[model samples]
Each structure stands twice: as structure tokens, then as C-alpha cells.
Target: MSVTNSFDQLATLRAVLLATPLFAVGLTLAAYLLGICVFQRLGRPTWLPAILVAALMLAAVLSLTGIPYQEYQQGAAWLTVLLGPATVALGMPLYQQLPRIRELWRPLLFSLPLAAGLAVIYALGIAWLLGASPTILASLAAKSVTAPIAIGITQQLGGSVALLMGALLITGVAAIAFVSLLARWMGIRDERIIGFALGLNGHALGTVRAFEIGPTAGAFASLGMSLTGVLTALLLPLAWRLLTLAGMSVGS
Candidate 1:
């Protein structure tokens, strides 16, 4: 009788949590806040940054509670909706630095294609070398862009959007969390270089991480992200075609 009653109570609680939107929203905000606090208390180190901590905590909570991703997303969607506006707001600071940025436009034009092309080449090459399936490779080809854009590209390429999104999210987080350390270790100074690399490789998560370093880094990162996004969108299809052609040539 006691065991049966405990199971009944647990089921009741689960249903209640799933029904309440606040449950998911509150949990997400709280997790991020706690992550910030923990990161600060640890002396603001990069290895365990606040964003990463918050993400892990949220993941752990969801896993432990057995909450479906859809259920959590219901509440988190409100916050996710703000991402675009927030990123756009970052452009103001970049705008203030436009004179400096303008001076680099010539370099920017030359570098943009190289950066975008290399990103796609490396992603596809590594995946191919690892012997990933064509579907998986197709999905991963656009992994550097934001998820929505990536999904669109994946669809055009006959890949699963779901698989693209999964890989996309993982790479975004991993890049944001570790790229700075990697940059420093590799002796790549210059905020512009760091910021640009972060934006190109990390996307939104990298932009956020760049802000933490300094305003200048943030501005450069925003530029890198915007440039890469436009370039990637415009060139990805052509790049994919060439890559496939090369693959066919090599195989033959």
C-alpha cells in the first residue's frame, strides 16, 4: 500500500509540473542565475564559464526529473524568442566603431570567403574522413550557422534537420566553452582575431562569450558572426556542390 501510494504521488507531481509553464521558465532562469553565482564564486575562470555551468545544470535538472524536452521548451521558448533582438542590440556598439570597421572592409571582403569556405571544408572533410553517412555529412555541412538557417540548408541538401540541429547545438556550446582557452594556448592574441574566430566558429554562443572578454571583442565577434552568416548562406550551396564534385572525382 505504501509503495503504491508513493508512485501515485510521484505521477501526480510530474503531471502538475508538465501542466505549468512557470515550472519550466522558473527552472531555466534559476539555473542560469545559479550558474552565474557559482562561476563568480570560483573567481570568474574560463574553464567553467557561467553559460556552460547554467546549461549543464539545466540539462541535469531535466534529465533527473525526466522532463520531456518539449515540455521544458514550452517555458524556455519565451526566453529563446528574445535571442534575435538581443543579438541585434549588440550591433549598436559595433555601429559606434564603424569608422574603424570601415577601414577593414577591404580586408573583410577578402577574408570573409576564406573564413566561410574553410569552416565548411573542415567540417565536411573531418566528417567524411571519419566515414560519416552522406545524410549525416549533408546535415553537418551547415552546422556553423544558427539552427533555423542550418535546418533550411539541411533540408535543401536532403539531410535531416533534426540531426543538423543536434550537431549544431553541441558544436555551438563546445566552441563557446573551450575556444578561448584554445586561442590563448595557441598564442592567438588580438581581440579582433579572437572575436572573429569565435563568431565564425561558435555563432551566437561565441558572440555571448566574446562580450564577456570586453566590448571591443564583442563588437568584432558580432561582425564576424554577421559576416559569416551572410557569406555562409550565400555560398553554402555552391560550396556543397563543389565538395560533392570533388568527392566524386576522388572516389573515381
Candidate 2:
């Protein structure tokens, strides 16, 4: 009788896990924690960031289980919703870095538009060169912007949100790797410059990395990310429209 009861309890637990969103949430947290453990154990290597590890683990589990991404996203969307509040929280650090920002405002003002413009241009240019369809180019155009803004831009340009999300992940990881290597090679030691570049190029992932470096770096990263998102959202669509009017075909 006791053995039967034990089996029944296990069955009940399995049913609950399958029926509720808790399973997805729990899996995500577990994978992230495991990634953190591995990252620490691996001496915190830059190439093996915790987020990347978590993503790989998640992908493996989904693939092995044959679970559709849409189902998993149903639960994971809760976490995505929190990104806005988390971004707003960065204002505290930005406040702390106000003096530094004021001192460097001139250079930052000049660099922000230039960086934002190049980010869109280069991504579109590369995609066009590869003969990507217009939809693909649109999706790639806002790769450097933050998620919420990127989503809007993608929608405006009639791009695939799914593709944009994938692009954002790839861009973030690549930005972190390249920025680290280039910073070391160029002897750029200022965390401010590094953090700004990371945020401008990588968005949330870069901001996370900047925070890991220090509060000042995190603050600058938040500023860069916010500005880049705003600039890209405001201008990319207009630029794309102008190009289209001029008969600049993006290969479908």
C-alpha cells in the first residue's frame, strides 16, 4: 500500500508540473543557476558567460524534449515583462554617474548619433550584401537596440520578431566577446568607454556585463543603451523609408 501511495504521489507531482507554468519557470531558473555555477567553476571565462551557458542548456533541453518554443515562451514571457522595470532601475546608477556624464557630454553627444547610425547602416549593409530579403534586412536593422524598442522597430519594418530575437542574442554575445578582446588589444582601460561601447552594441547583455565590472560602468552602459534604443527607434524607420523612396531595393 505504501509503495502504491508513493507512486501515486509522484504521478500527481508530474501532472502538476506539466499543467502549470511553474515547470518552465523552474527550468529556466535551474538552468541559469547551473550556468552560474559552471561560470564560476570555469574561472569566469569571458567566452563562457553565464547567460550563454543558460541559453545552451535551455536549447538542449527543449531540443531533447521536442518542446515547441511557443509553449516555453508562454511562461518565459513573464520574465520578459520585467525587463522594463529592470531597465528603469538603471536610472539610479545613471544618477550616480551624473557628474561624469556632464563632463563627457560633448564627446558623448557627438558619438551617440554616429554610433547609432553606423549600427543600423552596417547591419543593413551586410545583410543586403548577402542578398538577404527585405524582411530579413528589416529584422537585422534594429539588432543593436534594446528588446522593447527593437520589437517596435521590427514590427514597423515588417520584420520577423523571432528572427530579431535571435539576432539580438547573437549580437549581444558577439559584442561582448569582440569588445573584450579589442579593449585589451587597444589598451583601452577606462571602464566607462568599454561599458558605453558594450551597451551601445550589445544592449541588455552588455549592460549586465558592465554591471559586473562596476557601478560606474553599469551607469554608463545604461545611458548608452537608452540613447541607442531611442535614436535607432526614432531614425531607422525614417532612413529606411527614404532609401525605399529612392528605389534602393533590398533584394525582395
Candidate 3:
């Protein structure tokens, strides 16, 4: 083969190699690992949560590569599939705090629904008030839930998957970053309340944040995140139905 032909073959092979599903998955994992490495090296500051850093890095990769989302999703779906098992694992934490859960069951009954409703209300309602498109409103409805459930809700409601992912990422990151500051500002010193706030507003991210605070808070956060997710899942659709009936739904 000619020297130029061998060079051309190498370029073609490299392009084909990077296009695989495994490469996509590897890219995601590498981005996250890189973020963690950076965080560790930088002393783990609040401003640079590993996931957010990873997401930013992944976005850079996607933008630079010009690869379509569909191709990336093919590999990323592997991660997506694990959300179900992770959700089930959340019950273990809840079980450990069963006594606290019982003791506070009364307030929880009142508070959880409010938490779930408000997350959606603050997100979608504000968007609606600001004249956001119907698609935007629908996408925001599940912004507080964990990603898997949120994505399911978004898809079912005819919202954009990309929008749902973006909203969830932003919401989670904000929750982790601001929850502590907001707690101090609001005079919420109680760990249960702190956990509830994190779980209700942040979902999985909030739960992770809660764990960082304390185990009791982590348990409450798990409970709060699960309850909020359930409530949002049920209520968002019902409310969306009512809005549609009232002729408020915008075409997707």
C-alpha cells in the first residue's frame, strides 16, 4: 500500500472506532472520573460538585464532536437502566430510620405533599407565569424527581427528553450547592427538616447532599425524595390533564 493510503486508513479507523456505543459510554465514565479527580485535587468545593463538573465536560465532548444525541443515548442508556435498582436500594436507608419516620409521620404527611407540589409549582408555574412555551412547562413539571422517573414522566407528558435532562441536572446541582446556604438563611437547624428540604427539592442529588450532612438527614432525605417523586409523578399528570381540559395545553 502507498504511504498516503496507510495514513488514510488510520484516520478512517480512528473515526469508526470513536463512533461505537462502548466509546460513548467510556466517554461518559471518563468525564465523570475526570470531574472527581479534579474535585479531589481541588479539595471538593461546593461550587464544583463532581457531577456538574462531569456534565460540563461531557457537554464539551458532545459539542466538539458534533455527535447526535441519539448516538450518545445509545451508550448512556446503560447508565439509565440502573436507575430502577438504585431507587429500590433507597428503601434500605428508609428502613433504618423507621422509628424516626413513625415519630414524625404526622408532619411528614402534611409536608411531603406540599414538597412535591411546590417543586412542580415553583418550576412549571413560574415558567407558565413568565409565558414559557407549553413544552417548557411540561418539561419542568418533573424537574424535582430523580432522573429516571423524571425522564419517564417527561416522555409520557410529551416533553422533550433533552429539556428534561437539562432541567434535572440544573435542579440537582442547585439543590446541592444552595441547600446549606438556604437552610442557614431560613433558620432551619433541624436535620430532618434539612433532609426533607434536600430530598423534596433535589431528589437523588439532594439525598447525596443529605448523606454528606449526616446519616439521619440522609434517611430523611431518602424518604423525602421518594415521597416527593411519587407525589410529583401522580399529581403532575393529573394537573396537566386538568390544564389540558381547560384548554391550556400547548401543542408539542
Would you list the C-alpha lDDT of every candidate in the order shown? 0.78, 0.89, 0.84
Native-to-model Cα distance after best TM-score fit, residue 140 in candidate 3, in Å: 1.1
Model 1 regions more than 4 Å off:
151-189, 237-252
lDDT of 2 by residue, 1-252 (tens): 999999788778755665678888899999999999999999988767898899899999989866778778776877777777887888899999999989899999999999989988888888899999988998999999989889889999899988998899888888888989999999998989999999999999999999999888889999999999989888889988898777756545
Query: Which regions of candidate 2 fall more than 4 Å away from where they truly are?
Result: 1-19, 248-252
Q: TM-score, each model? A: 0.80, 0.88, 0.89
Candidate 3 clashes between residue pairs 3 or more apart in a chain or in different chains = none
What does candidate 3's lDDT look like per residue over 177-203, in tens digits? 788888888898989889988988888
Q: Least lDDT summed over 10 consecutive residues: which range in candidate 3? A: 243-252
